[model samples]
Target: MKAKLRQLFRAVPDTWKTSATIRSLLFIVLGLLIYLPIMSDVLPKTFDLNVNTVSGVTLTAPVTVEDTEATEQARAKAVRDMRPVYARNDAVTVHQLKLVNFVFKKVTDLQGQTETTPDAKLKDLKESSPFALPGDTMPALLAMPAASLTAAAQETNKVVTAVMQKGIDQNVAREEIQQQVNQQLVLADLDSRTRKIVREIAIASIVPNVTIDEEATNALKETVRRSVKPTMIYKGEVLVEKGQYISEQVYHRLDAAGLLERNASYLPFFGLAMCAGFFVLFLAFYLSQAHRDVYWDNSKILLLSSIICLTIIVMKITSMGKGINFFLPGYAVPIALGSMLIAILLDTQLAVICSVLFAFISGIVFNYESLLPVDFRYVLYGFVTGVAGAYSLGKATKRTRILQAGFLVAIINVLTIVALYLLLSSSTGWRDVLNQSVFGILSGMLAAILAIGFLPLFEGIFGILSPMRLIELSNPNQPLMRRLLMETPGTYHHSMMVANLSEAACEAVGADGLLARVGAYYHDVGKMKRPHFFVENQINRDNPHDTLAPGLSKRIIIAHVEDGVKMLKEYNIPKQIIDFAQQHHGTTLLKFFYHKASQLSETPVSEEEYRYPGPKAQTRETAIVGICDSAEAAVRSLASPTPERIEQLVRRIIADRLEDGQFNECDLTMQELERVTKSICETLQGFFHNRIEYPDDKQVAVKQA
Candidate 1:
């Protein structure tokens, strides 16, 4: 049972290839699990409170929340309570004055009629005027002297004009306008009967000149409403005590804060599901667009999913400590750990993307006591710290550099916390600020430590070739490298030269230089099994192939590639290094042995028998390493090696490999190949360049010193 469990754990990731649909569904489900805990508050819960019942349990605000419904209701009431705005219609006042003047002009024109009798003139004045007057009032106006009648008309016009100029709007009542008119006539010189007639004229002419301005009134009310901030229920604030009755206000507050399960709405959960779906789709789109190679590889996908799931689980566990949450911030969780590990194992660009995704996940999972489920403070803290770790480790080629990256992450974490505190927080108490800053710094350091601890496990389980792993393998003190040096010194030197050439060329062509150099170091490990059989290690000038048949020699030569693969697997070496061991020869023929065999055989010799068994180079780095291996070997054999001769040899070897289709599987562009040739030539030329020589006696004296 133990063995079966171990085997199942080892092979499960590989077995996912059985169904693509299942694999995609599994990824989606993993996303849901990672996000579900953060969204649990949104799901429905049961509230066991009756309308007038005593509270069974004390309820407090889980998070700071705004009473949006109540706030909006208050704003609406404020708008309704506001006085309506009004605008003056000067045109209506002007027309009213014109009608009053028209009545006075008709009275004057009727009085000027010489043939008309006093009674007829009075009746004519009434008929001509658009305004109506009392019969007794018109008769009195005609009976009075002309000067007195003119004075009364002038007084009436003055009173009416003054009322119109006061600017009456809809807000001004008709009685107010009439009161002002009556007051003005009380002090007039006109008789009581004449004053009564003028008062009636003035009242009729004064229309309500004030009109309601709906747009202006609404705009003013909206401005006031927006100015009023919503009243918030703060986190940790008391809602209901142990024995307190559950009032309507308390029930509503609980419902708004998402504490009442009976009032719980699934709308928020649906929104959460949609958000999770969006994250999944966005990740897929980003991977397909930016990293097609990783997108297509199921193993990389599995590895990525595992890291995200593990990180989120850790965050959830840390956030679950409600007691600790009072002292330690949710933002203090070590969210940068995943990014640091990923940056070391994968590309920095992918690590940067992982930083953003992890930050978003952190905000959701650590949202306790926050106003919103997505806490921007935690998001900022996570993103800055994660990216800092990745950027710090981007160019680091040693294991100890991980420690330096951790310090960098910690410093950045503290700065981010400080900045967010100043920006997002309303209170700036020194104690809270200093405490948060300390937690942030500790969080960053913890991330670095966690990353360091988890790195080896991830590398081993996933078979990942991290930079640190490559560096470890490249050390000469390793068992394999040391054994090669002790048993086959010449081959070791040759491998070192090949490493230098391949590394330079890979860098020139924008490939993984470290991987190429490390791969070159291990490429010829197969030759160590038969050290004396190969020419380089045969230091005594004795040729082992001379007595043996050409077929036998060829068989011995071909056995090394397979032997190396077995040896590497036995030592549990990563597949990346094993690829170099397997593909360095790349099906090239052993021409010296094959030609010798052709001369001795009676039947025609087949080219297949002399060639090394190969699957060919599967990547640009592997292909370049193979080309460099051949170039270095061929150049070493030149009796009079010069810059021109070395260049020709390197170019010829690459051309032959190209013609033989050894690089066909790999995507090596023509431009990149030319750059590789140039880089290798330059390195070889310098290595073989002229060096000053001294006498043997002088050399012995220097060696003694």
Candidate 2:
């Protein structure tokens, strides 16, 4: 039972996921809506409008009274206005219809309002009962009403009922004429033709001419089919109820209004909303990434961020098919933004792992719907390309380097795009393929550029110190380290030794050897300001501590650490190195001086006076440095160095560190500590190995120094 409970608990996130849960929920909810348009049948077979060239006061007269040549005359006039609408390059084609988000649904629940007016603007623009509030704006982009819409097309009877009862606006007649002339007919020179038919219609209405009516009816159908729309519609809706006929001229009117666009009649705003949702997710992920401290450092956020990236790619694919993509791109923006910090401040491989997961998750998230094979090569190539660029650029301190690396990645992306395009699609025309190839390479480069540009934002946000930063600091020629080498060569050499030991110990426990090495190099910089006070630089021979009392000697000795921090601050040492320098000694006692103080005093000497003022080690690297520093010093004092003696000394130092609570807050465990001791002993033993004496007896002593 306990094991089961532990397993259940272990499966839970180590950190809270308030934001992740919200985003995941958002993805699932929106995905369902996007996919719903694929299966419904009551959708319109086509979006071609039938009502065109609405003549002056062209009213939907009651069907109860239509037995005359006037109807025939109307049909004739319809033909003349229409021929130009379908004529190629005539500029009078009916395809120039608009489908702006602004809606004007013809449906009214109670049929007619009896007052001719525009539609009510719908707050829910994509709903089945599409309507536009008088004040609301329409979609800016025009839609070609096509055969694909079934859902909204089925509502024609309902639409006709609303139209006949409510008597749609007189202004609608004028707007219809204006839309044709301004949007289509005028440019096609149908301006003159439309006018002629209207004049003839006026003559026919007054005279009741049969031939003219037939010509006019044909003209209207031709004139309104200027636009075409292809739709993915929903199931079972009233496409054209009991009282409608295709020849009733309602299709013409619907097409002109954009309601005739196949599936659009049911969900007018679907595509636009998909695009908008994508933008929303983009912005959300961007804002989420903004909290670098919370998202960049936490492993869960890093993992989930990849998931978010892939989901967006999938959403973009499913939202509008393959038509909307640019070139192959990755979560390079987030991954690169987080990489340097993770590499420099955390761990290199973890950063690499984060990037790897980001690439693969994109495949899972991009849910394609067609039977046609999905081309994931772009995503795959982009991931490989992006991760490569991120790791390459992550080591840099200069912002420009990030961009430079990104540019290179962009080139790789383009190649991948071209190659993948070829493999996925069999079209081999270089003229056609060249553009894609050029674009693909450029896109990859752009992703890198974007990543580079975004790096500073995250760096500043997270306070990340990169590898380049650490390396810049590790240079012995740097001002502070140089000063140490010049003013106190002995202390500098001592630091080198500590760095060697620390680096070895750190490697034993799988910590970054570079950081440990770098930290050890600057750990004793404070001793530089007062070289004579430390034993290493006291070469000319008088011991400064010999002239002083034990307590004063301890004070002087402890003061070096404070002085070093101040000097480092003046020279601007980075905080990590300063931490290692200060914390490595911790509050460890100065046994030699403390014992002297105790021997001389009538009252007992307090341990506080002899201890180094320090914060305990906060990281494994710093704790390893502390142990190594003590062990190195203690080993130097060993009377006869041997493998066992060195091992004993290293163990005692680590044991003492544990006992003193030096590692209380650090993550170093007993197992890791033991490994560190073994490594240090192995290193020291090799360095101080005993050799067999030569029979010549002129053998040199082992190089103990």
Candidate 3:
């Protein structure tokens, strides 16, 4: 049954990971897609740029015209003729006068048309089409203005195609089409005054100087000419005829009316920058992945992500404070990336490199203009804040500390702003200083708050285990440790002693003393499952060993190491601590059992079976524990522990363990072993500080020893 269960659990990992990988890939693609459109540029920078313009750009008339009054007359004629017609009456009436031979024929016998309804009217269209009028068919069509008629006529493809395909030469056909269109427009009836008022409206428009590639320009020109000129009026009189004067208002009016066409590819270029920038950021994240650590894992990936987010935020910020031309003396890039440097990367040295990169990026983004020198103060600000942030919060950082560091950064940012302003601006006023100072202070706090807020997200995203999280987990109130203490007090006490010795030895050897201590605290947690089997908690009681035979005793006790490993697994304790529990008692002889077994039966029973099954101590901390656990028990067993005897006993036990090959797996040097021996002797001396007595001084010791 147990073997079957193990086989079942083993299959879960592959299935789980394969599904997770596929899901993660999908989300990554989705996120990348959504993020691209918001990048620097892709769509038109100004929506107005794509609008069809309503006026020309040439306000500069031909030099051949030389009269101010002629310009005025020309302007008056333009305003009168070009004004759009409006209907103030109760009903909208259509005008149809002098219908052309082509227009009439196209509606009937010219082409394939059995029914009047065009474009195959649907149910919805059938109700909405003007041809489905309330009255009888062919009510007298009211005459309409030429411009409106021409615009509507643009949809008359049959008429236009007929004119083009006629046997007439191209030039002659075009001229005839124009003249025929004008005659039809003139005959279209309206109030006499309305017709007279709109007599000189010209059909000219303004196109901007677009700097597109040849193909795009040609296509644009074709589209504009067809969409605009084909829908214009050419009747009665020409407004702003050949010699009209154009004013700034007219130019602006035309520009607003969809006549503007400036074809610059600045938009796509900006989008390209945005994509490149994000790609660079992701690349930085990839390179920084090598530095990720556990309990020490924050890396350049976190810093890079932070910078990317901050760069976007600062760009938005600068946009809000528009017209900062050089006003931003420094950029926000360095501060953001640098702030995350210490917690993630673990190397303060690499932080400055990040800062320089951020500085350059900030200068590009936050710098006020394309021309003139960038005030460089933003770069300086970014570099300083980043370096300072990284250095300040590099190790053992808590959330509050990260935030406090940001506040300190804020102060520095303010100072930097003030200094830069004083150095570069003219007549720096108190108001200006105050504003800059406030902005700097706010920015700094934001940096700190943002960093603190994002740390957990990064931790989860990158599988980073931070020291702060480890410390919190190590706290005694944590569920696992608390259970150990409450359910297995003796094991807990023994673990504590081991922790102290190991921590001290680890510190003495320049190792991670905290990790050693934490590991030690939980190393023997498995003993809790069978606490009474150990002698540490056998206080005020007879020796259980007296009742049990040596072989059974050795087996029961030797089994604790394996038992501990089982317990560690059940609790899902980390591998490092489990290693200590398994190896602290190396495969050494349990001599007391072998001696007893020999006395009972001299048939040469193997001593190897009585020993522990171990791979031995593999680190200084585990080795220290093995020595200390024995030293403490041995010293406690002595009936009379004089200082010299205790020292001798400590040395002998250490020697026995050493020769038994107990410390072989660990990297403890001879010098370190001697130090460990001295340290134990010294610590024991403190614990057993009751005064020594001479032969005659047993009675006197109570009074004066």
TM per candidate comes to 0.73, 0.51, 0.51
User: What C-alpha lDDT does candidate 2 achieve relative to the native structure?
Assistant: 0.53
| Candidate 1 similarity to native, TM-score | 0.73
Evaluate model 3: give its lDDT. 0.54
For model 1, the superposed segments whose C-alpha errors exceed 4 Å read: 1-23, 41-60, 66-232, 236-253, 368-370, 692-705
Rank order (by lDDT, best first): 1, 3, 2
lDDT tens digits, residues 569-656, model 1? 6777787899998988888888999999999998999999999999799999999999898889889889878999999999999999
Off by over 4 Å in 3: 1-341, 344-375, 394-400, 427-433, 443-467, 545-579, 586-619, 639-668, 690-705
Q: Please report the TM-score between candidate 3 and the true structure.
A: 0.51
In terms of TM-score, the best-performing candidate is 1
Candidate 3 lDDT tens digits, 1-705: 443433454344544433535434433443343245334322222223222233232222211112333344554454444423222211111111112323323333312333534334233233433333223211211133345334334423323333223322312443454554344446545444333222211110001112224555455544444343111211111223223454554433333322334422445455545544565555445444644331122222333444445545554555444335334333333255344534443455555555665554454445442222233766677777777776667564366776777777777877887787778678577677777777677666767776666555544433334665546547899777898888778778777776776677667766666667777777667667666767776667677777888888898888878887887667545455677788777787888888988888869879788888887887787777777777777777788777888789889988998887787767788788888788777777766667755657667786785
Summed backbone clashes in each candidate are 5, 81, 31
* C-alpha RMSD of each candidate structure in angstroms: 8.1, 26.6, 25.2
